[model samples]
Target: MRRRTPRVRPAALAFATLFGLADAAAQTSYQSMGRLFTTPSERMMLERQRSDNRAAAAAPATPAGPALPPVPEAAPAPPPAPQRVGGFVRRSDGRATVWVDDEARETTLPRVAPGAPLPVDLGGRNVIIKPGQSYDPSNGTIQDPR
Candidate 1:
């Protein structure tokens, strides 16, 4: 009596072939790949390797002169200018002018809810922000912190 073999799907056959090829290519070594010690080497071989590595590492292959003093690298460029500051809120508006110590500075801030902390930069000084006040670039004044 003749035995019948199971028929394989063409898609499955192709997938199996491709997957096998990719896996074979990815795993090219016949030896153990990782530190899991799946296939350990002979004790003598490991001892020999360890000894060779120790000898090679203990002494520099090349005879080199004393190391030179390392020249200090230039100090890193100063950090970027401070962008934001912590302070009390004076007004919450998208368009507002600010005063940076005698010099009037025009700055725009997003609209903020009433009673929320308003950001007021008074010439690098602390300033309190009032609620419901929009930051009008034209009129920059009286933004003093409480």
Candidate 2:
């Protein structure tokens, strides 16, 4: 009696088909006009799409991830007002000219401390001088305290 060869199992054949050589075109999606595609332009377009799909399928896969949030900006600042500074400077004279912020004192005394406050009567009103500041008597300037 002659020995019989064993037939290929259905499961084995199915697995071979499932994991076998894959056609690059099958991996990509493209429009198909089926048997209706007839014109030269349509045929050329279909042929071009086939080539594009083949190239795309051959390329490696890229990783997908979530997007990041945008950052916020700050507002602009304001400019500063003008400032006046400095105290009195006495020269060789009988009356010491005491100057405040900008005004030079008319009533010259014999001696006084460099930054010490001086009392002056402006129209029967007394005014005290401060350091690094001056009083403009001509302009009737009123300086704010720091």
Candidate 3:
């Protein structure tokens, strides 16, 4: 015949019974405990968002300043003086033609009359003609030289 062996310890058996009862009680109460309410930190974040929205809605609509006047346009300036190059004296034609650096230019005047000094343009350097003297065009020199 085979010998019989002990299967459970007295202290271990009592501890197992206590643990099973505690697990059953926890399971039964799980649904009865309601969900946690909103925390303080979440409430503060919501309040801050509400304040920001209210401030944006209350902001001013128009800019603060007086209107500016319209500006007027300016007029254009006059042309510059012509540069003289040479002159001519015409005794026969009774007219002198003044030559400018630009060939297209021709300023003519009556020839120097008696008792009046002859008008002359020495070269493209200077204008030696006195007042009332005619500018000559035939030659680049003054006629009736004083």
Candidate 4:
């Protein structure tokens, strides 16, 4: 009886070599071109920041100039008018429901503490309404709880 030896196929060997080379090329290209691409505006902003840093580093220390008259601060703006009416309603399931006059649906609102006062814009007056209490939107007054 004669013994035969096992042989490797040429096509299979070529496919394995091709895949190995492709994987290595992909890793090399990613390492070479991995810098993040930025938009034109971002590039300009970065350039401006770099120039400012360079200028500050190059400038020499000098004595302060004469103290100019202190610029007057602008007056603070007034508070905005109330836009809508809303309040909290305590549910039997230990959660509160927030009802807004303009919104179509009421959402579950969790309070930091139970019975905490929730701010509501009633007409033009800002009123603090507690859970389980009702309010009148027309007059901005609290109504008897139902």
Candidate 5:
């Protein structure tokens, strides 16, 4: 018996030829044709692109007008002086009044609760008084020093 080789059918040959032509055409289309910027048309396109980029990079100039003057800082004001006074509250109504020597001003204190000490300010000194504590307005005494 003699051995014979298998032969490719007509349809198979036509399909192979079609696939080969498609592959060749795809490769030719995808191949790079050097750098596009080397051509004169491409160089003109690049120059226009660079000019647009430069125009964008340049900042817009400010309009000419009157310049704003610098603001001046304000000077600080002086602090107020201290005050001192002396007085006692009435045991019955809890109302008290005091007079300051330095300012020659008199101020009445609000009603204090029972058993609460009375506070007064005169010149720069402060004095507190309990019930039966005598306060001297002339010498600014907290207690009887005699």
Candidate 6:
């Protein structure tokens, strides 16, 4: 028995070639070409910008006004001294006295509250200090113990 091979028809070969070329063209990218070319509107905009830059460069620069005197740089200020005060509590003649700035200031120990303000004199200046708080005589800053 003799074996006969299947033959490809001319119409089938042409159809295959056409479809293959069509698929290849559909898959091909055109981004590089797009970057190389610009639309008419874009070209006009570019030309307008170039003309504006050229006009600005050709125009005469305005004369500068009289130069102002250079400002002198100020020296850095020194750090402020620490504002702190030390006090000691003393009981004399059955009266509570707070010694601040080496002066005795009397206060009612029974009337002083933990959070309430207690009036006291520091260096002849009246200042308020809470029972559980610290007082700064230099700046009159109150610091809560809590």
lDDT of candidates 1 onward, in order: 0.56, 0.60, 0.56, 0.65, 0.61, 0.63
lDDT (Cα, tens digit) per residue for candidate 5, span 1-146: 99999999999999999999999988887785555567899889989999999987796867498876878888876544323333343434544444443333444565777657666654345567654455555565656323
Residue-level lDDT of model 4, residues 1-146, one tens digit each, is: 99999888999999999999999999999999977745888889889999999999899967599767989999887654333334456677755556655453344444556667676544445567664566665445676455
lDDT of 1 by residue, 1-146 (tens): 99999999999999999999988977875444655443456666778899999998998677488877999999987643322222223345545654443344566665667556556654354445554333323344443343
Tell me the tens digit of each residue's lDDT in model 6 across 88-142.
3535554676654444656645455445555665446666654445566556577
TM-score of 3: 0.24
Q: Give per-model TM-scores.
A: 0.26, 0.26, 0.24, 0.31, 0.26, 0.26
* Cα lDDT of model 3 by residue, 28-113, tens digit: 88867855645898889888999999998899756468766777777766443333334444545544554444343344555556
Distance from true location, Cα of 7 in model 3, Å: 3.1
Query: Once superposed on the true structure, which residue ranges of model 6 sit more than 4 Å away at CA?
Result: 1-94, 99-115
Backbone clashes, candidate 1: 16
Q: Model 3 segments beyond 4 Å from truth?
A: 37-146
| Superposed model 1: Cα runs more than 4 Å off | 1-43, 55-63, 85-112, 118-146
Candidate with the greatest lDDT versus the true structure: 4
Q: 23, model 4: CA deviation in Å?
A: 6.1
Better of 3 and 5 by TM-score: 5
Give the clash count for each candidate: 16, 6, 9, 0, 7, 0
List RMSD in Å for every model shown: 11.5, 26.7, 31.8, 11.5, 23.9, 19.7
Which 10-residue window in model 4 sums to the lowest lDDT? 79-88
Q: Candidate 4: which pairs clash?
A: none
Cα distance off (Å), candidate 6, residue 55: 93
